[model samples]
Target: MHCLEVNDLVHRYRNGDVVLDGVTLRIPAGSIYGFLGPNGAGKTTTLRLILGLIALQHGAISIFGLQLAAHRIDILRRVGSLIESPSLYDHLTATENLALLQAVHRVDEAKIGDVLDLVGLAGTHRKKVGEFSLGMKQRLAIAVALLHEPELLILDEPTNGLDPNGIVEMRALLTRLNRERGLTIVISSHLLAEIERLATHVGIIHRGRVLFEGTLDELQRRRRTHVALATNDDERAIALLARQSIAATIADGRIVMPAMPNTAIAQVNRRLVDAGLDVHELHTAGDDLEAIFMNLVSN
Candidate 1:
């Protein structure tokens, strides 16, 4: 079942700036859905609408099988979020900061320690939040969101400005959170590499429109894989491949051909050898995801 659904979302500001234009999304339960786009592509706007930070100008939103507009209070109770930055007191320790929010959330104070451990900040003791690294602060903010134990997690550019180690830490933390808590995570980022590493499902948005929405595997299948081979008789190889219905070309002295199954590749090798052609090298060059993403947004 889908944990969140947005249909034909069109939000225009009073100044006539439409940040979301007929946006639609369906995030499956227990999947880490990556909301991907260039900066200013309406990722933040969509998140804000889902969180009720802004009134919806048009369309519909549903979370956990309930319409968001009609069940805002109830739906929000089951969603946690860290948007843009963490709100932390420079002078207060991690424990102190969570303690402050705990009062409003009204959960047992004992959960403070639990959340800190979950975020791997339990050893901070009384160290001020100001002393924590950016990654630590991000985790703390996530701990804040987790304080209420929401069933879904939404984060906007959580890995932005994080170092490599910090990125890895955040990925592992998010994966563990999803695995252990059964949390449906929706994260937005312009960094393709980050999204590629963490997301189970992907949504590519551009200029306020979702260009693509599907599982990561579905998108990966779109990658263009080609078999490249180095043959002694390039002319004969091309003819042999064409006769076999395998598109082939000689580029930079290598016979490049369209993607084929392993059995087909083997057959091609055998046929080439039988035709008195020496096949030197055979391999597949997988498409780069950045290229695929560029093609999508450009078209």
Candidate 2:
């Protein structure tokens, strides 16, 4: 079953500036879904709508077989969200902050220690939130989100502003939460490398529209690799490759063509040698995520 489903969602601000247009997404249960987009691409806006922080302007949002509009409270009861930044009382200790949320969410107070351990903040009960690192603060926020034992967690840019080590910790924590606890997570971020590392499913959004949505393998397959070759006679190499029905181009004084298997590359190399052109260098390139993202958004 889908953990979250968004269909033809459309949204705009009071000034009539459109933010989301016909955006649709489906996240499977127990999978980490990465919502990727540039700033102002409506990722956060969509999250807000899903959380019922703002009214849905158009289209439908369903969570775990329940529609957001009709089952807002029930849906929210099963969801835990940390958007943009974690709201915390800096003056309070980690335990105290969770204690406060436990009262609000009416959760078992005993779960506090368990969650603290779950987020790697154990034994820091007396440390005030103000004294914690940004990464620690983020984990505390996640701890608050988990107090209710919600089935789904939605986080927006959870690694934003975190240092390298902090990013790694956050990544590990999220992975553990999904794999160990069987919780479905939907996280939004513009960081391609982070998404590539952590997400089981990916959705690329650009200018308020979903450009692509699928598994990482599927997205990688959409990216084509190319072969770059340097030779003494670029012109003859191009002609020779064309004679074999291979399209070739000259870029930066090198003969470049779509990537082929090792055998095909060998054939091309042999053909070039037989044609009296000296093959100087040969390498395979392309298949970069950033390049694919740029190409998808630009078009």
**Cα lDDT of all candidates, in order?**
0.92, 0.90
Residue 66 lDDT in model 1? Answer: 99
Model 2: per-residue lDDT, tens digit, 139-159? 889898898998999999999
lDDT of 1 by residue, 1-299 (tens): 99999999998988999889999999999999999999999999999999999899899999999999899989988888999888789799999999998897789999999999988999999899999989899989999989989899999999877899989989999999899889999999999999999999999999999999999888888898899999887888898889988888887778889888999889999999999989899988877878778888998
Q: lDDT score of model 2?
A: 0.90
TM per candidate:
0.85, 0.91
Clashing pairs in 2: none
Model number with the top lDDT: 1
Off by over 4 Å in 1: 13-15, 230-255, 260-280
Candidate 1 lands at a TM-score of 0.85
Give the clash total for candidate 2: 0
RMSD of each: 3.1, 2.2
